[model samples]
Target: MSFPENKLTVRSSADLATAVPYLIGFHPADGSIVVIACRDRRIVFAARDDLPAPGTPAHHLRELTAHLIPVVQRQQPITDLMIVGYGTKEHIDPALRVIDDAFTATGLAVRELLRVTESRIFSLTCSNPACCPPQGTPVDPTTSLIAVHATVAGLVARPDRAAVASRFTSVDSTGDVIRHATTEATARKAALETAGSTAVFEAGVHAVRSALRQHDNDTPLTDDEVAWLTVLLTHRPVRDLAVDLTQPHDQHVTFWAEITRRADQALVPAPATVLALTAWRCGDGVLAVMAAERALQVDPNYPLAHLLLQALHAGLPPSAFEQATTSTHPNPSIPNPNTPSEQE
Candidate 1:
């Protein structure tokens, strides 16, 4: 969902419709409601949620509004917003009304309210039938200039959300390789345990630097290297070091995605969370959510993944995390793994 810092103007509703897929990195699911917040004519934040069911209560719609308003407020100074709902009138109308009212209460204008069916788009706010026909206006992204500009700007609109999630799915047929590497890595860790916590911690720091160099050179880590790194990342200090090293770049995404997919199942949370953080920093919220959800699937109590999910849900920008990280320094204490007090 990343775009250049330069502003891309939307002259008409049709152009906005065409640009949505590119902005979110995928076409939204049917029955979904998308909110795009703008500040002083620049697109700032975007979020999506499912429309309420047919029999849903009025309070349920209120709950939806409750969830969205805070997110919009967190991205404050939002001058206006656009809401697009993909579904039938029965489902979309009520939800749109609740959301629009809620946003307006917060003093932000609703620029456009649109309902998108399979073949056409209907403007709920526009009464004029000439430009926005009563029967709805046809929207063909293939013929859209906005689509052309988005493509030329190197933005990709995946066919659907699932297609974006598939990017982090496990690589095919590497289970046996990872298993054998895990066994060796476990033995090596046991030997290092006898040496002291400092030795294991230093080894992990070295491993992190070496892996970064390998990724920089466009050389994927071997099965053994992935195993050792994932095992060491279980150490909190080591994981923190890895997190500090991650940057907002596609290279970091590729590097961590491979590590996440190749790690043994029990060791997945660390690498997956790192991948989530990296994607968030890159402005790829869809990927960040997918990766964070994957980590929680492996370990529900993983605090870092939970924190990342919270930030994304609150609509906080990546700079929020960058500022926090830069302001705090790493703890200086390092306990020896051989000490009884340090053993978990």
Candidate 2:
């Protein structure tokens, strides 16, 4: 099923008639640009027909190399995407407002983080592979093989967002890296681990609200694991249910109680876990900080702990902590008023 070459504007994909492969040629005054195909049709670039597809390592290399043209040119044209220059780079960077309007109208492009994570309508859509055989529907792969390389790299780069997340082994192997609602479960799991899992039975399941996006209607906790989650988040305030920190401090108590009661009824009660968790959840803030620092001292490899301190200190306003390290210095040239002369 090869797609045919097109010389005219593809106002929409409907204009494209090929199925196997396709070529979209872009001619600029500087050089002829070509986009053989992209994950999305909207992403055209400028370059020669000299690389593998986007999924291949070779193609990525070419993509990086082509950006040099613009740097040589001094000023980037509307279509310029990189300094190396790209094939479809001539299309013109859409204005932020234009892109927003386009998204509002068609809901297609995968450029924005939120856009990358928006809910997907899996049932409403079907890729060629869905009927062909479960090639994981092309969208969802057979296994999500949590690209260890990619994950580790991302974790290292983004300490705050790099969460201790989870995904079904299969999805982690094959699913698209994008965040469609289908991926929300994975993201939420990561938040659960990263947000707070140290406390055993004390329910402070303070996951970032990736939970709300996936199950916004307040769906009942059907899975035993989910019920456990309700139990774990007992330490969180009811106001935090929305992951909103602006709410009053006491809001989460009731939610925590319900969670505790559910967890309390497990066939085999895990009291040890509960007691340890109780200490964690009810512990004072200063104690938490000291414990956190001590944990760092003990084993600096703890991913969340390292990131925690980074976020804690870096996330503060400059003015708030700028002077915390201030120290008074004695002047060597001037004599001390009270005979403290031994300082060298």
Candidate 3:
């Protein structure tokens, strides 16, 4: 995901290290390699992946390099690249070499290479001991100027990927509630089928809007109400309608997150994909990846989830989706039911 046009001028290796977590939206773990793509020193996108295991064959590096080139190219022409390896000297060296060789082959400039440990950061490109000491320099993110600006902009740097994923976890008390909702939803589905697809779509649209309103008013849905809405949303027309109707933000994110956790995967792919799209639009790449994985698990051929996965992997900025949605469409206030449907 891309940050706002917030100015984060990186004057030193220490400044770069401090900005990595904010750029990627998480504090990376050990053995992770982070690639920050920039155009004229403004970050276009940042991605992180674990260092390939020791003894990984040459072909693996080639495959990774191939994947990265297109991802960077798709967003914008990468004028410069900063590669940061988060591990010990031995582990990071091979990975760095492989990445350097790959990018060089692609004719992309490698602006800098650095290594980050638990307590210090070392600049591989800078030989001047006065600036980048041979041993390393202690890096404190808290005291950095970028950290102060990020806080003012309401940006948060999560602890790790796992911490972000934990937001979608289901609660144990919902077991009986889910089972009851499923039964009710199934019965409603049978009745609606008899009324045909249009009726089903209409009912689903109404139910979805009502549910969102209830969620806004802090009114809890009954188990049966949740079940009916969940099942209705499985239909493609209904699901697409829901997507077209809602806007993305904090409360919408929370609503989809809870609904995704509550919905039975065996019953529908809508909740999972919706959750993925919402997370992606909100620039929570880690959570977006997890939700997309869950949606694919439920229905391997699900096109919406698959498309989102590709975009997420390609490091498409969240602003791309936001702009596309708003430039062509009007405000995201609730849709009028009397109007013609956007999806059949």
Tell me the deviation in Å of residue 134 in model 1.
1.8
Off by over 4 Å in 3: 1-3, 6-9, 217-222, 316-344
Give per-residue CA lDDT, model 2, range 1-344, as digits (tens). Answer: 11122222332122221110112111112222222222323323322323233345543443433332322122212221211112222121122223233323432332221100011111112234434232211321112222232233221111111110110001232223222322454345456556454422112223313223223345433334433353333332321222222112222222322222233222112211221122223321122233344334434564334433442323222223223412222223322233322321
Count of clashing pairs, candidate 3: 0
Candidate 3 residue pairs in backbone clash: none
Best by TM-score: 1
Model 1 error, position 204 (Å): 2.0
lDDT top scorer: 1
Give the Cα lDDT of each candidate: 0.83, 0.26, 0.77
* Error of model 3, residue 150, in angstroms: 2.7
| Superior by TM-score: candidate 1 or candidate 3 | 1
Error of 2 at 96 (Å): 62
Error of 3 at 221 (Å): 4.4
Q: What is candidate 3's lDDT per residue for 1-344, written digit by digit as tens?
A: 22446666777788888888877778998889888888877777777887777678878767877787777777676688889999888888777888887887888888888999887998877899999898899999878887887777666678988766666656546777788779878888889899888778778877888888799999887767777888888777777667766667767777877787777657546887887888777766777888888788879998778877877887777677546545754444435645754543
* Error in Å for residue 178 of model 2: 27
Residues 142-218 of candidate 1: C-alpha lDDT, one tens digit per residue: 99978888787767899997788777777558888898899899899889989898778888877887898789998
User: What's the best-to-worst order under lDDT?
Assistant: 1, 3, 2
- Worst 10-residue lDDT window for candidate 3 reads 328-337
lDDT of 2: 0.26
C-alpha lDDT of residue 312 in model 2: 35
